[model samples]
Target chain A: GAGVSQSPRYKVAKRGQDVALRCDPISGHVSLFWYQQALGQGPEFLTYFQNEAQLDKSGLPSDRFFAERPEGSVSTLKIQRTQQEDSAVYLCASSLRWTGGTEAFFGQGTRLTVV
Target chain B: SQQGEEDPQALSIQEGENATMNCSYKTSINNLQWYRQNSGRGLVHLILIRSNEREKHSGRLRVTLDTSKKSSSLLITASRAADTASYFCASPTQGAQKLVFGQGTRLTINP
Candidate 1:
């Protein structure tokens, strides 16, 4: 319960539909990250937040992918007009430090299936 | 380019045997980390080796870093069936950005 928590461990969506995934990071963590992992592949960075500021979103595959951490605590990753390629396990991680060298705490992740 | 690439994409060994996995990165890194993921679960942080550190150990896990080679290796001694899972190596780029991951090595410890 002390670790990161993500909602709706599994989700099914139709192609061309929109979906929103939620992540509640450990309280007071300064760095939050979202990653996309395709089946049998490693997680790819999607975006990052240092508190409420989205410092980098270069990994977002397209404009259809958008993520926000409005209050710097809970974050949402919303995909608009999702396609089959968008199906993957969406992972959320948080670290106490704002830098890269620290170990991050991860959530169970939401496995999204699109058909 | 992928920041971290792991080799021998998969590994299988018997219980009580040792398992070793390798990883290489493309760019300079402040530190390298290893994680393990069980089926349908989140990744669990295994260890972190800084650029300056050559070797570190935690329980049955041993990690060695070769910054000159821009590579690292993870070893699990006296493996157990419970160790069966996917192991990944990740490196952090930029001063304070995020972690880039490798495809990971699927390790199976058969009894």
Candidate 2:
């Protein structure tokens, strides 16, 4: 693909429900990242993957938030038992570099609204 | 968790004026990168400055990195209304694969 792509641009979920957001990064990109952005705020890191390896997930807000990149190309972010506070835009970014310090390409993002 | 902090949470300036924003990081970093975000477009990478480099330029964007102080600044010359957006600085964390981004500086260009 030309750029990072995310599915279901917007989502509306009831409290206690589970939601899954998907991301398809650029072809062969080595690094992928997920972030949560609240209204009127910057994107906050959620997790990072280096070719299917979940190197760091310390940024995940709680145990309810989970992410996976089994093939290193497509990633999914799943939130269980969504709460009102879980309403935010979920962003996915991919970079060519194996490590950090490289320019990253971002998807349009998925806006999740938990009611 | 966020390691970088961008000063002057919001900025407003005339279209033709210059706009500047600063970022400070808590830990040492090998490099720092800047990104811009707006309602029309998603996040876009602007520039990156290595620790060894003091300054770098990409068209009208000038980025300076001071490793000793663990800080960086972005300057936009002759800003335009289209340049209005939120800018963020990010640095490597938990090794070098992931980045910890700042809260960001919201820039508004008035015509």
Candidate 3:
């Protein structure tokens, strides 16, 4: 793909419902990142992946938030028992390498609403 | 938590005027990068300035990094209506790969 792609551009879930968001990063991208952007705020780092290895998950807000990149190409973010506070735009980004100088390409993002 | 804090939470400027936004960070970073978001969607990469470099320019965008003050500024010259967007500055954490972004500055170019 030309750029990172996220599925279900918008999702509305009832409180406590579990929802899964998917991300398809650019082919061969080695570094994948997931971020959560609240209303009127910048994106907050959720997790990071290098190839198939999950090196950082420190930013995951709680045990309800989970993310995985099984094949190193596609990723999924699953939130269990979603709360109203969890409603935000989930963004996916990928870079060719896991370096500070490399540019990251972002997906349009999936807007999740927990009501 | 966000490591960077952008000044001027919002700015409204006339078209053709220059817009400048400043960002200050708490930690030492290897590089600082700027991103723009429209309609609160995906973020577009603007410019990046490494810690060793003092300034960089690309087209109408100019970025400056001051490691001593742990601050950076983004200047958009000859702003247009299309330049209206939220701008954010991101700096790498100790991990180097994970970037921490600031709250961002909402820039509006009134025509």
Candidate 4:
């Protein structure tokens, strides 16, 4: 792929509904990350994956927010019992490696509106 | 959570004016990177400065890092209407692959 790609660019969910966002990282990328951006704020870290290994999930706001990269290529972020605070853009980024400080390419993101 | 903070929540400037935004972070970092974003969109990587490096330039963008002060500044020379966007600074956590971003500075270049 040309760059990181995310699916379902926009989503509207009612309170307590469950939603899953998908991300297809760039070809051969070894690192993937998830972030949440609220209106008028910067993106905040949610989770990170080194290949298929989930190395960091400290940034996930709660246990309801689960992310998995089972095959090391495509990933999924699932939010259960969505709340109004979940109304934000969910972004996915992939980088070449965890070291060397390489630049990460970002996807357009999925804007989730919890009504 | 956010680790850095960018000053001047929002700024409006005329086209061709130089736009400057500052970011301050706590704790030590190996590198700092700047990004830009349009309204309700993904971020675009701009420039990165390693801890050893003090300043770097890319096209019209100039980035300076003051590790001693734990602060960095981005200066966009000859700003254009197209440059209107939100700018954020991110620092990767030690031994971690994730980047922690700042609050961001929303810049508007009026034409």
TM-score of chain A for each candidate?
0.97, 0.97, 0.98, 0.98
- What is the per-candidate TM-score for chain B? 0.97, 0.95, 0.97, 0.97
Candidate 4: lDDT of A44? 89
Per-residue C-alpha lDDT of model 2 across residues A1-115, encoded as one tens digit per residue: 7899998899999999999999999998989999898887778888889889998897899999999999878999999999999999999999886466678899999999999
TM-score for each model: 0.98, 0.95, 0.98, 0.98
Error of 2 at B9 (Å): 0.5
Retained true contacts (fraction), each candidate: 0.82, 0.71, 0.64, 0.59
DockQ winner: 1
Q: Specify the highest-lDDT model's number.
A: 3
Model 1 CAPRI quality: high
- For model 2, the local distance difference test gives 0.90
* Residue pairs in collision within model 4: none
Q: What is the lDDT of residue B69 in candidate 1?
A: 95
- The C-alpha stretches of model 1 lying farther than 4 A from their native spots are none
Model 1, range B8-58, lDDT digits (tens) per residue?
799999999999999999899888999999989999999999999999999
| Candidate 3 vs candidate 4, DockQ winner | 3
How many angstroms is residue B10 displaced in model 1 relative to the true structure, after the best TM-score fit? 0.5
Count of steric clashes across candidates, in order: 0, 0, 0, 0
lDDT on C-alpha atoms for all candidate structures = 0.93, 0.90, 0.94, 0.93
True lDDT of residue A26, candidate 3:
93
